[model samples]
Each structure stands twice: as structure tokens, then as C-alpha cells.
Target: SALNLQLMSLTLFDVFGAALGVFVVLTVCKFVEEELSNINMPEMKGKEGRFQYTITDVKITELNLTHADLQFIPEVGLLFDVQNSSITLSFHRRILYWFFYDTGNINASAEGVNINTILNLIRDDDGRLKINNITCDARIDKMKAQFSGTLGRVYDFLASFLTSGMRFLLNQRICPALNHAALVHVNSMLETIPVRTEVDQYIGIDYSLIDDPVVTSRSLDMNFRGMFFDLSHQNDTLVNYAVDPVIREYDRMVYLALSEFFFDSGMFSYFTAGIFQMDIVNEKMPKDLEMLLRTTYFGAIMMLNPALVEAPLSLQLAVNSPPKTSIKTSGATVVMTAIVKVMVLPPGQPPVQLSSMTMVYTHIHTSFFYFFRILLDFFDSNIFKIFSNQSALESLALIPLQAPLKTMLQMSVVPLINNWTKRGVQIPLADGMDFIEEVVEYHNGFIVIGANLHFSKGLREMISVMPPPHMAVYVEPTEALPYDSDITD
Candidate 1:
């Protein structure tokens, strides 16, 4: 009976070992599946009603490829290359019951991995960013996988032989699998990240590449020739007019050079039509001004303020701003100057008009108060002086109006201009790219943004399904091109 019991115990142990092997393999597969499944990218798509870019012809040049964990110098003028790269990875678990001293190890190795790729940036006819002239070669030199435990020395010996066979199978499969995986990622990135964004209903972004991008050992250089458009005034006299030195600086990753922009005079005509107008009527005025309105010297005031009449009075208010715009910038700030006009129209009298130029300076990124906040400053308004010379009564009445009028203009009109500067005109070219830093500038008629795109640190781990032992090697420092200008410090 004891002999039979021992036989049954041995049989049970064998079954358990087999079951444990199955569990280990299944666990590895599940881990990989879970990791890949968690890559949700929908958030990269911009929210509705937010500005989104539809980038076209994004020409990336001179991309540097390196292992996520390794770094070494390369030969001069040679693009960094990977050849016969190898990776070794292992996972271990301990069994503490009947197989108390046993440890399970799952080991994987890859050798002779090689890849070369070249691509061109272009926009399709439909205005989508496209990779053109793509050419790539990927190959796995060798691959091996093994599962080993405390079965016996014989099992370990056999595992090595089986691993060789598995390596061949994996080698045959890894190349296609790797290429497919990379394609999936690239397609996802292009699909979700917009290249052309709407600054507003009336403005749009143009990011077409103006010249071929240059690649060096250290960085890729991209030259862009794009500007903003005012949709409502396409045919204005100065719409297409621009001066020379369109791109004056290229010191950072993003640059902007703006020469001039024209706003149609009619853009502010609503202000001229009495949107800011108020009637001066005796019924609504202070007793002092009301008594003064009844006198001959104040009779003119009665015309403007019909409330002064014995019968119910009728009055009309009209306000306007004539259109001319000039814009300049200094140290993260923009100053804008515009001419404005105000008019008062009585039921039967000629319209009275007053004119002045309103200058506003907006400081970008100047404070810590609001998220992405900007400062607005109104400098030296003498609008009331125009009313002062007309007459004493006119001057007295109009002086009180200036404060409210200034507040209204500052609240309503200045913000629109500020928004135009922040969203419509400024371009954040490097923000969304996975590996990029940018400096932005503006000049004559173009936006000159110098961008640096490279292999970011830890990129290998980000894309790896499991951690592997390897270091990047042969990373070469990039040489500056003849045309390269370090305008940014």
C-alpha cells in the first residue's frame, strides 16, 4: 500500500510541474497583451471647439536613431547606425511549495538586428500630412527563447537545443512583426495629431514646408514659409503685400517673422454706429446739467439730450471707429495702434464726430496669476481733450463720458485684439511632437521657427513590450550647417 501511495504522489508532482509551465507561458502572454492594450491615444485629439492643427508636408530630416539605454560617439559626418544589435531579457519566479528550491526563468535574446529607413515629408492633395518616398530595411540576425526550471540537468540540456529551433522561428517572424508594429504607431501619431489648426473662425494656419529639410549628425533643420490669413479681407490692398527679410532669425526650434497685416476699416464700423453711444437727455441728467440745458448756451445740449424738452424727448446716439491698424512687438509683447471715431446724431441735427487713436500694449507670459494669461495696458489716452476745445458745456459733459467709454473699449475691443495675437498669430510648432524643442520668432513677412527634433531619452522603454538589456551606441554629435544661425541663446 505504501509503494502504491508513493507512485501516486510522483504522478501528482509531474502533473503539477506541467501545469506550472503552462501558467508561466500564459502569464507572459497576458502581460504583453495588457501593456499594449493600455495605450489609449484618443486624448491626443483636440477637444471640440478648441484650435486643432492639420499639419501638411511635415518634413522631418536627419533623425538620429539610438537605443533607449545606451549611448556612444560615432564617426564624423556619419549618421548614427545600428548593426547587429542584440538584446537579452529574462523574467524569474520562485515556487515555494513541493518544488521549494526550484526557480523558473523565462529568457529571451535577439541578435543581428538591423534597420535603415528614409522618408520624405509631403502633403497629399487632400491636405493631410504624408510620408513620401519611404524606404526601410529591417532584419533580425538571430533570436532565442527558453523556459527552464528545476526539472533536471537533462532538461536543461534539451532546452538549449529546443531554444535554437525556437530562435530560428522567431528570427523569421520578428522582422515582419517589428515593421508592422512601427507602422501602427506611426499611423496612429499622424492620424490623431493635427497639423493645421484653426486660430479662429476668421483665421487659419499654413504649415507647408517651404524648403527641403536638412539633417545633420546632431539635429534636423526645417525651414518653413507660412503665415496667417485674415479670411474676411482677402482682397484688401495690403493682404498679399509683405517686405523683405521675411525670416530674420533662426536661433530656436520655432520662429515667426511678421512684416505687416491689414485690418479692414469696416471691421470696427460697429463702434462708429452708436454701439457705444448714449443720449444726453434732461430727464436722465443731474439737476444742474438739466437746468443748464434750458439756457441758450445749453440749447445745443438739449438737441443731444431730448429729455430736456417739456414734452417727452427723442434723442439719437452714434459711435464709430475708423479703421487703420499698426502692430509691433518687443520682448514677448505686442503693441497695437488704431484710429477710432465717435459721433452723436440728434433727430434733425448734423452728426457731431470725435476721433482719436487708441494704442494698447499686450504682454505675453508676464505673470503667474491666470493660466496662459496676458497683460493689457492702455497708454496715455487724451480723447477728452478733443471735447474740451469745442465749448465749456460740451467739454464738461463729455469729460464724464470718457472714463466709461475707455472701460468699455478696454473690456470689449482690446480682448479681441489680444486673442488674435495669442491664438491666431502665435504658432507653437514644437509642443506636440514626441521629441522636439522650439524657439519662436517673427520677422518681415514670415514666421521663423528653429526646431530641434531628436531621439528623446527613455524612448526605447516607452515603446518596448518588455525591458531588455542593451545600451545605445555610436551616437554622433551633429555639425552645424553653413546656413545655420544660432539666433536664440
Candidate 2:
């Protein structure tokens, strides 16, 4: 029975080992599930007085580098070990126990290992985990000098590599995902409005004098008389007649249309109007002897009585007068030559008027590099040095190692939200131009269809109390309209 007792003891040890292994696996599974499940996405209300469902709880756990524990290995002169390798990143709160409980059932077969093994499995050849060699002088005097110089180069190279990788991953992947999520959120909010039709109308009226033969002759005579005598009163009368009620009506219509759109859409945004040409043209009068009589008489009298006239007038008269009657006739014919012309009244159709309204949605996101830089700076300080004597080297190497993980985690939520945007949602309230052009322009220079809002101080304050990310609606005429048939119908 002694041999049987020893065998029983060995069997008990095996059972205990198996139980411990199970516990570790269960813990890892639970953590992974919780990290993946707890994401926070914002909810938005539509114009139809309905709510649009978005992923307020967006959890990114798979590649989260923040969960990793760093370690410095002086033997290899490289920081390669990470502990508690699992991390849970989410936009919202999560129930850790429940997630792990279910995960345990699914992944019961695979055994869980230490954090270092997990990281090493995923580490690249040139990654921070790679072994590094350090050479130092045998003499104790030179040991410090050699160690500092060789390790310094290693540290600098590692830092540069990590910084570049982090920047590259964020710019290429994480930023795009964030951009897509924003676009989806905007589009979902836009779908709550009921109307999707874009209407733009232009109206213009022009007025001018009807240049008939009689009117031309009279106008020419008036001009000639005005030159000889003051004609301010006559000029005023001409101006009043040329500008008609019809032109005033055109201007009024334009103003009314703009006002109505603004009032109906509840948009008090400022707009600017510009005019290219506001001009007047009169017909030319046919040759008239009466109109030229003043000029001819003045010329002849000045020439005949040079002693009674000023020197300038005498010279003008001498220059103007001809020697023979035939020559005088020719000169008068040339001077009095005038062609009768009719005024073109803009074809009795309205002139083309162009008006534009710009609607902007100002949304600011934290810079991609800002958060990374903050993390980098924080780790560089002496405070972080207490965590590891060789923290500088570890920090530099870990920077690049964490880049891909950061990028992967940051962008992980994008595809899911993007799909929701493309599916299209409908809003139920009577919508205006603001509802039609649901365009969401991303901060990174991309745009998608969504409702745009320009809010006032009061409205913005009201929205601030509500949960983020809020939407603002602006109404302005645009070429694009929403694809939803219910709103358009």
C-alpha cells in the first residue's frame, strides 16, 4: 500500500497543475471578451423626431498596446519582456466577469501561457524584442565609458525606429478609422430629417429706355441743350424713367426667396450678394441740323468776330470753320454724322442671377500625434525611470513595438460604423435644404453624405448638455440631396 500512496500523491499533483492551468486560461479569455465588448458609441436624434442607433460602446481590445507591461533586460541590453499582455479598450464601460465566463466556455481547450510568451509569438525579427549585443572594455576604468557609448547608440536607434513606426501606423490606419466613424455618426444623424429635396430658383429683372426714333431725336436734342445749359433736373427725370417697377420686383423676389428659405429652415446664417454689371444704354439719334445749330453758330460768329471773342475761342472757330461752302457742307456732314439705333431690352427675359450659401460643420478631433507624443513624453521623464533602471532604452524600443498595436486598435471600430452609414437611415420630420444635402466632410479631407447644422449660441448651449457626439443641422441650397426616397417623396 506504500507504492499505492506514492502514486496517489503524484495523481493529486497532476490534478492541481491542471486546475491552475484552467484558471489562467479562463482569466485570459474573460479579459479578452470584456475588452472586445465594452465600446461606447453616441446616440443621435433625427429630424423625424426619432433616434438613430449607433455604436456608442466601441471596444477595441485585440491590439491594444496600453495593456502591456514593459520590462528591461540588461543582459541583452534590450527591453524585450512584457507582462499582463492582454488589454481591454472600449468606448464605454463593460462587465468583465460575464464576458470572461462566456469566453471560458468557447476557448476551454487552449492553455494560457505567460505574457512574455504571447508577445514573443507575435514579435517581428527586427522588433523591440530582438536580442542586442553590448561590447565593453575589460578594464574597470573604461567599463562605464564603453557601456554608456554603446548603449547610447542602441537607445537612439531604437527611439528613432519606434517613433517612425508609431507615426506611420497612426496616420495610415488609426486616423482613417476615426474619420470613418465620424462620417457614419454624421450620416446617421442626418437620416432623422424627413425631407430630401434640393430646390434652387433664380429670378432677375432688367429695365432700360425703349430707344425709338422719336425718343432718340428728343434725347439728342436734350443732351445738346444740356451741354449749353445746366440739366440736373432733366438728368434726374431720365434716371427715374429708366429704373422701372419691374426691375424692383425682380430684386424683391430674390430677397423674398432667400428670406423664406432661411426662415423656414431656421437658419440665420449670413450671406453675401454681388452684382457684376448694373448699366444703362441709350439709342443713338439720327443726324439732325437743329441739334448742331448751336455749335455751328458759335463757330461762325467766333470766326467772323475774332476781336470780340477770346483767343482760345477764336482759334477753335478758325480751326472748325471751312473756307468754301462745299468744304463747310462736308465738315458739317462729318460732325453731325449719327446713326439711329434701338435699345436691346434684355430679350424680355429675366437675367441670370447666381446666389450661394455656405454651410459649415466645425468638428475638431484630438491630433493623432498629440496623444502619442504625450505618452512618449510621459515615459521619457524621470518619474517613469523608477519603473526600470534602463527605462530609456526600453521606452525607445517599445515606442515602435507599440505603434502597430495602437494603429490596429484605433481603427478597429471604423469598418462596423462605415457599414451602417452606407446602409442609409431615414428621418421622419418635414425637412428643408439642410435635410437634403446630408454631407459629412471629414477633418482629414474626405466627405460623405450627411445633414449639416450651423447652430446659434443658445442652440449650441442646449446641445452641450446632451451626450456627445452631437449633430447640428444647417439649411442651404446645394446640388446634392439624400438618397432616401421616403424623405424625397
Error of 2 at 118 (Å): 41
| lDDT for model 2 | 0.20
Candidate 2 local lDDT, residue 294: 18
Tens digits of per-residue lDDT, candidate 1, 349-438, equal 565443232322332322111221211222223332224434466556555544554554454454544443343233332223231344
How many residue pairs of model 1 clash at the backbone?
Answer: 43
Relative to the true structure, candidate 1 reaches a TM of 0.46
Candidate 2 residue spans exceeding 4 A from truth: 1-154, 196-489
Best by lDDT: 1
Deviation in Å, model 2, residue 95 alpha carbon: 32
The TM-score that candidate 2 achieves is 0.15
Error of 1 at 103 (Å): 16
lDDT of 2 by residue, 200-276 (tens): 11111111112211111101100000000012121111111110111111111010001111111111010001111
